[model samples]
Target: MRMHEHPTINYPEYHWPAGKRCAVVFSLDLDAESPFLWLHRGQQVQQLGEIEQRRFGPRQGLARVVRLFAEYGIRGSFYVPGVVAQTYPGLLPFLLEGGHEIAHHGYYHERIEAIPVAQAEDYLVMAQELFCTQTGLSGLGHRAPSWEMTSDFLQTLERRGVSYDSSLMGFDHPYHVGNMVEVPVQWTVDDALYFRYTNSPRDKTHPANPGAVLDSWIEEFEGVRETGGLFMVTLHDWISGRSQRLRLLRKLIAHIRHDPQVWWARADEVAAWHAASPNRDLYRVPAHSINTHFESATRG
Candidate 1:
């Protein structure tokens, strides 16, 4: 049979709650060293320095991030992989105690679509279960490890009662995938593409110019503010927490915070607000980009 073609995705206008002009979500993927392990698989042990670099997030960078957020009174959202949460036991307690939101990231930081459907489901289940076991409640949101997404995996999330997901860039605003909302994310807002560098052959990213990143993010803020859209800024403990990158992040935050119309919220809060609205499925965006094609093929 010829490959099935999904209908052209429609771009619909979506609004934020509370009369806010822009909903800004500081979503952190606390992948730590797990991403390197997931990306390299069996070769992770060979990339010792990369592992150490990744560890910098939880080891020292996390404190700095925490301090900055406290200074700004921002209750940021953190997506913690279960392995990382288990590896660093004190991390989640401090985050929760500080009024931060801890969301589910995979268990082993596995790429959701790269693994089998059962494995992907297992990763999410383990992550969610561990989060519940650790915090005595469920995490309301999920940002798939490396922002991976698949239709089947999305179905899993909906079936398992996830309120929202942040792994897909389906639109400039949140849209429903069945009952579960997708709080969209884009690479332009992700810190890993702009930061994260190492000497290892497996290390492919280059250090982005801080000034350029700040300008781009600020520009994005302005554009999103106009639409009253959700500005889902994706950061990683290991990348954006670096001192130099952290400085850039500070500037970006300051710039966005300067606008009184910007609503600083956690990922789960944004998701929950969107979920509570009956208009969640009110808009739809085209998900058939080149990336979606690759994703569809991969899922097959």
Candidate 2:
């Protein structure tokens, strides 16, 4: 199908009721390092063949994240890697019990853009089945690991019962990608920023300084709210599971909870709202060569 042939996706435009400003969606990436790193490096592959660190794994971190979300009375999406789900069967039930949504993050956490098209399709299918079987809930959302999704990957998701994908960045609101609505923008407020700022290199095992990250995020949130847009915060089990990070998350949640206009919701809930509401053309800019400052603040 051609790029613009798909139906336009319409999202809701609910005003803050008087004092409200913006909506927030928190998404967690549940991934295991062994298979994920192995697929990329032979050294990690050999190391994984020797060690078994299943106990202090993705599920453990997920449990912590879920607990934190429950404390805030908020529901978010948990995008799990298939390998992680198979390794930890108890994780899915805990998420379901907490009323969180389970989304697919791909099988084995392989980079779909690097793999062959047929192989990528197989990986996506495997992920969907493993997530459904273990969780007893079929996932409707997809997020490519490492934020690496090509056009082919998007097409594969459209074919695999995926209703939305949250891998795209630089868009302020959700938009249709072919026949699927993409929950665009990830890495807006992530632990990776700490690593980048510290020049610590990208290591998921490293802990994130949550207070500093949250402070920066709050600033971004205020900016988006003033402009009437969506704020997407991406967290990873391995990174945000630390005590310091969790504490920062709680503080951020407290601020969001006090605001009546700020809707703290799940990705699916936001998608459903968009589908049911009228299209307001929220992200369109009036002129060519849009200024980066305005685009950065309002683009989904």
Candidate 3:
């Protein structure tokens, strides 16, 4: 395998608004089987275990997670699919009540890279409209369904007036995906890799132990503190909402709270600060580079 040339985002010299040591962005994704549904449309009836596991999110996990945030008095960026917002009406309202940042996570969790451009446009447009209609708030951030970023997708976000995205793995700090700011995410800081399973024979899931995940994330935070880079954590309600894993998340937050220098921010605030950054241009991906990088990733 090969690697694409990563973004040359210079986080070392950039000054944070709070002057904190490093930034920690905790974003929770409420995909809730929408991606599975999109992938298995015709056979949706047969995937009972998948359906119930995902259903566990909205049914019990959401409120638990919301209350956990309240206990800590810190807000998370909640990215929900448009269909999810519609499917579970109370979930959005609860998030809004907690003063969390609500952002777009594709309408049905469809992979924009695999769909036609027009189809992708319609899916995003309807999702944006429907979510706004439901909540009366428009999204300022977007996280691609499968962490798949492309030129067309970035353009779509730019045209929609979205200020930032949290889908790419290019850089840890907030940087540009075209004119749109990207808050990078990594597999290491995510719980799904450790927890999610689909009963597939080839899928090698991580251990059921939550301490391993907790310990690894702390290491990441401490290491990023050196450069004062942003530490973006991607979590799923369905996977991380279980009792033990939720405890893991709580401990993670508690551990971070121990550090007085860590800046706790939502993704939008990070984007706003980065947008005003004098070194902003250093991270901007030129028009042609998006396609070039995507091609390289595909080939590699």
Sort order, TM-score high to low? 3, 1, 2
lDDT tens per residue, model 3, 142-201: 888878867787888888877788888766677776678888888888878788876766
Clash statistics: count for each candidate: 1, 6, 0
Question: Which pairs of residues collide in model 2?
Answer: 20-261, 171-299, 171-300, 172-299, 172-300, 173-300
TM-score of candidate 3 on Cα atoms, chains taken together: 0.90
Q: What is the C-alpha lDDT of each candidate?
A: 0.79, 0.68, 0.81
Q: RMSD in angstroms, all models? A: 4.8, 7.4, 4.1
By summed lDDT, which 10 consecutive residues of candidate 3 come out lowest? 287-296
TM-score for each model: 0.88, 0.78, 0.90
Prediction 1 global C-alpha lDDT = 0.79
Tens digits of lDDT, candidate 2, 1-300: 222322335544544323446668888877656344545565534544222333343636667877888777879888888777777777777788888888888777887777898998998888788877776666478888888777777777777778777887635666555555666664657654563221224444554456667788888888777766678888777667766677888888877777666877788776666555453234332112223343224546
Q: What tens digits encode model 1's per-residue C-alpha lDDT throughout 1-300?
A: 223344545545566676677788887888898877777776626537778988999998888888888988899988888899989988888899989988888888888778899988887788777777777877367888878787778788878877778887757777776556788888888887877677767567677789998999999888988987888888888887888877887888788877888878887777777767755656543333234233334543
Who wins the lDDT comparison? Answer: 3
RMSD of 3: 4.1
lDDT for predicted candidate 2 compared with the true structure: 0.68
Candidate 3: clashing pairs of residues: none
